[model samples]
Each structure stands twice: as structure tokens, then as C-alpha cells.
Target: MENFRPTKRSKLELAAPVSHKNEQFWILDGNTVLEVGGVLFKLHRSRLVDQSIFFSHLLDERNVQMDGVVVKSDENGIVYHLSNTTPKDLEALLQLDKNPMAYYLVPPPFPVLAAIIRAATALRFDTYRAFAVKHLENAWSSSVTDLTTERKSNAVEVVVLARTCGINSVLKRAFYEMVRVAGYGLGDGEFDADNGERPQEISRADERRLERMREHLISAWLQVAVRVDRTFICPNQPKEPTAGTESRSSTLPKCPSLYSKRDAWERRVHDSGLYAEYKFDPFCGLQALIDIKWDEDEGWCSDCVHAKREVWRTMRQRTWERIEVWMGLDK
Candidate 1:
């Protein structure tokens, strides 16, 4: 008889099945098994889990051999086990996929904005506002030309919060540009912070982005306003750039007088000290002034002093409540 070879082999004949039932177990190459219930798996391509279940066993720096394929668990729940591949471990396994510098240059995902906003609010830092502005600005810039449903909703939220928190004029313009680009119609609905809908027309991705931005702005605004005079950017001179060689130049240029036609009128406000008035008349009704179609009948009339006072009073009350919460006085 001629020599015969079997193409199919039974599981028992091929190799022992790796059991992960009661004890922790990992099988490599469908043949090599490593168990770590109490016993640790020591391999050139393996790593032990850390004590804290929060994060996975960090890869050892010196023992990392790039030549051979190696994999480790990221206990962060950021990654999963099974080929042990997951989105969370993406940062660690990044070296295997691309250059390190390339990964660093990429902007973090939208979800990171939420965490950043939370941290900034907790720290009572205005720097978070700037970051929130930057992210919104970038989101607007990216989505403007695209005009997808997701982009429009994000743009709207950015516009609303950037205007409300008074982040910066530059960022404010970016948010506005996004609205114009996306062709979103405001309709009968108003942009009132307390009353506006969750923006159903928006994508879940953009909605999450806006939520983070709003959280940062509102939290930071409340914290700073209650603890310090947030009306002024800084105690001394808010206009002076904090970091730079050219902070306080005596010859700093002044803005072009709005009443340039009447230099005498300019001199009058300057002489009367009205020019130094803490509240700016131009910024009065900024919400209404910026939006041409906005209806002042929406109870935001510029001439209503009583209404303005009531608004301020309500804002102060909310401010106190936030401060109490932050200081743990409420608890």
C-alpha cells in the first residue's frame, strides 16, 4: 500500500486545549499556553498584569523587544483581551503601526474635551475656556465646508456657548462662521441657555463635543465669577499678555475711536471718566447685537434697565449656588 497522510487532525491529536475556565489563561500560537491564576507567565513576548485593575500591565521599557511580536493587556478597560486588540490600547501599540511623532501630532478625540473641561472647572482655571474655544474653533473649521448634519449641530452649540461665556472674539467669529457655512436656520427657537433643545438635528459626535465645551465654559465661568471679579481678565491689567517679553509697553496703541467723526465727543468721554467705566455700552445686549435676526421681544430688550438688573440678580444667585457647591458648603 502507498503511504497515506491525513489532512484533517482531531483536536486531541493536534494539541492540548488551553483551559481558561477557573484560572486566568492565555494561549499563544494555538499551541503555547500560559496560565496566571496564581502562577505568572514569563515569556519574551508577555507581561504580567498590575495590582490595580484600572490599568493593564505596563510594557517594560528595557525588556521590550521590537523584533519579535509581543502583546500585553492594558488594564485601563481602554483595551480588551482576545487577539488582545482594542481601541484603548491603540496608544501603546501605536509604535507597531506608525511613527511616534505622527501619533503625537494628531489631535485627541472629542471625548478628551469632556475630561479636560471637567478638570479645568474643578481647578477653576480660565485656561480651560481657551482650550474649549480652540476645540470648537477647530471643529467649526473642519465641519464648515463639509456641511453634514453632525457639523451643523456642533456649530450651533459652539456659537451659543462661545457667545454666552465670552471666551474670545476670535473664537466667537469661528463659531459664527461654522453656522453660516452649515446653512443652519435658527427658526422660531431661541438660543437661551436654559431653554434651548439638545439640538436634535446634530450628530451624536458633535453633540458630545458641544456638551464638553458647554461644561467647561459654564463651570469655569461660575467658579471664577464667584471667587474673583471675572469681569476683569486679571486683577491688574487683563489686556497685558501674561507670558511674553513685551507685556507692558507704555506706547500700546489705543482702539480707533468709534466717534472719530467727532473727536470732541471722544475727548468728552475721556475727560468725564466714562471711558474708564467698568461696564461697556457697546457690549450691552451683545447677544442681540451680534445676531441680526434676533428678536429683542424675546425679553432681552436693550432699553429695559429693570430687566437687566433682574437678569444680573438671577445670575448672581446662580453664581452663589455654584460657589457653595464648589466649596463643599452645600454638602
Candidate 2:
């Protein structure tokens, strides 16, 4: 209810010297005081110094002073002003010790987790940042299959998180996954696919990129689907009829007409609404196409089926490679 009293750290130090000490963090016997957003927090110097490189060096005449970590001292010992951070964010960082297990066992929600990570990064708290990052890595695994099981809702948040935290490893995948949120995919198995759930909000620049990528991604998927290359020979089928009707006669029935395999594949695509579903999820959709044993549909034969599957697989990889560029992440 008063005003920020300044000492000599910066012209911008916003520590309130009178009428305020954060009720939650003021410790009676604490050695150091940190003031952020006009509220003071009295805490142990060792708790911060031991866990953070920035804090370790901060308890000195020449401090990194980073962005906050400024201000005056009194009966509470050396007061450091952390005006650059929010009181809530500072509390989240300090509370890590009170609830260390929460970071590992049940992890905080993204909002809480983000506060911790952001504060940690600013304060050079490596352990705290790593703890939060581990949870993100788990959610955005390199394996797309594992990622599929995650809520598509999470991908957009991760895109922002990855960029904020400087976690480049997860950025591409997160952006790729976000395509589904923009109405790219008709549906996926694990996520809320009724098109009803609200996707996380992202920057307008990202929204524009997604719109452009959506058009290109659908085109890439169609490239593979429309090819439907031909091969008369069914490799898995023996050329010579061994014993009974078990031979090529029953299996091949007859060599499919020029484009019968293509037609049959198209029919199935139309039936499955696969085009709609896969437009946004090119990598997964392409893989799904590859995994199928096409011969079963219209007697295309194992050789032809495997050959087409190989083409689909190649397209899957190609799609994956282009995703970064498509999403504008390459820049």
C-alpha cells in the first residue's frame, strides 16, 4: 500500500522498504531478503545460492544484477531486488524446495511449471529449469507414436513453451503436432477429436505459418496417396502353384486391372475419411498408409503391396523432413 524504496542497484529497483513483506515467504531467521513487484520475501541465502549459479554470485558487491535482484537492506540483512520477476513467479521458484517431489512425481500444470522455468532461467537456476523441462520432454517425445497418445491440446502449449525455454529439440515436433488444432485433421484416436476442445492460443505469426503449412501439408500427403504405383507380380506369392487352390489362383484371383489397386485404395480412403484425418498429420497418416497390407484389399499381391508400402514409407520420411521448413521453424 506504500511505495518501492530504492537503494543503489538500478534506477528501476522496485523494492518496497516499508509496510510490506510477502506474508507467504517472509522468514523470521532468514539471512537474505528478495523484493519483487513491491513485495519482500525473507528467505535463507543458502537455499538460493546452493541451487543457483546466479544466486551464488549474487550475494556480493558485484552481482550479475541480471534483471531484478536489486534494492536495499535493513534488519533483514542484504536485500536483493527481484523486480523483474512477479511475486507469484518468485514464490513458485522458492517453493521448489518445499515441494521438490511435486516436480518429479506429479509435475505442476503448464502455467505453474512455466512460471518455475521462466523464473529459474532468469535467475540461472539450472536444476529447477531441468525439472520442468523433463516433464515437457516426456509429453513431446521424439517418437511420434508415443506423442500420438498425448492430447493434441498440449501441442500448441508446448510450441510456446519450447520457444520460451529455448528447448529447440522439441520445437519442430510441437509445431507439427499443432497443425491438428487448426482443423487440419478430421480426427485422431486419443485426442479430443470432435473439434470441440479449444486449442491453446498462440502468437499471430504462428497462426499465419500454420495456415500456410496446412495447405502444403495436405499437398504432401496427397503426393503419396495419388501415386498408387503399379506392379503385376505379387512377390510373397509363389510363382508356381504348389499343391491345391492355395496357389496363386486363389490368392491373385486375377492380376488386378491397370488401376484396380489404385481404385480400391481410393475407395478405402473415401470410406475412411482418411484424407480429412491425415491432412494435418502427414507423418502419422503416411505411416498408417505404409503399415497396411494392401494386397488384402483387391488381390494386389504381396510384391505390389510391399512395393507401394515402401513408397508410402519414403513419403512419410520426406514429409517429416519438410515439416520444419513448412512450419517456418527453420528460420
Candidate 1 per-residue lDDT over residues 1-331, each given as its tens digit: 9999869988786785442322222222222222322222222232222211111223344443332223444321112223222222222222212232332446445434433333333223344335544665565553222322232344454444444444333333333333233133333345544435444243444334434433433453344222212232211222656765566545443322223313432343344443333111112122222332212333222333234344444553443334323322243
State the displacement of the C-alpha of residue 253, model 1, in Å, after optimal TM-score superposition: 37
Candidate 1 clashes between residue pairs 3 or more apart in a chain or in different chains: 55-75, 56-74, 56-75
- TM accuracy, model 2: 0.73
Clash counts for the predictions, in order: 3, 4
lDDT of 2 at 133: 79
Q: Listing every candidate in turn, what is its Cα RMSD in Å to the true structure after a full C-alpha superposition?
A: 19.1, 8.1
Candidate 1 lowest-lDDT run of ten: 278-287
TM-score for model 1? 0.21
After TM-score superposition, the amount by which residue 5's alpha carbon in candidate 1 deviates from its true location, in angstroms, is: 7.9
Q: Tell me the spans in candidate 1 whose CA falls farther than 4 Å from its real position.
A: 1-8, 12-92, 96-98, 108-300, 303-331
Q: Write the per-residue lDDT of candidate 2 for residues 1-331, one digit (tens) a residue.
A: 9899956675444452443798878988887878777688888888878888887887755755555445576766667766557777778988886678866778787667778877887778898888877877776665555545244555666766677668877776666676755553323334553445554456678778778877887788777665464543545445765666456556543556657766777776656677667766677777777666667766676666677677777766666777678776677
TM per prediction: 0.21, 0.73
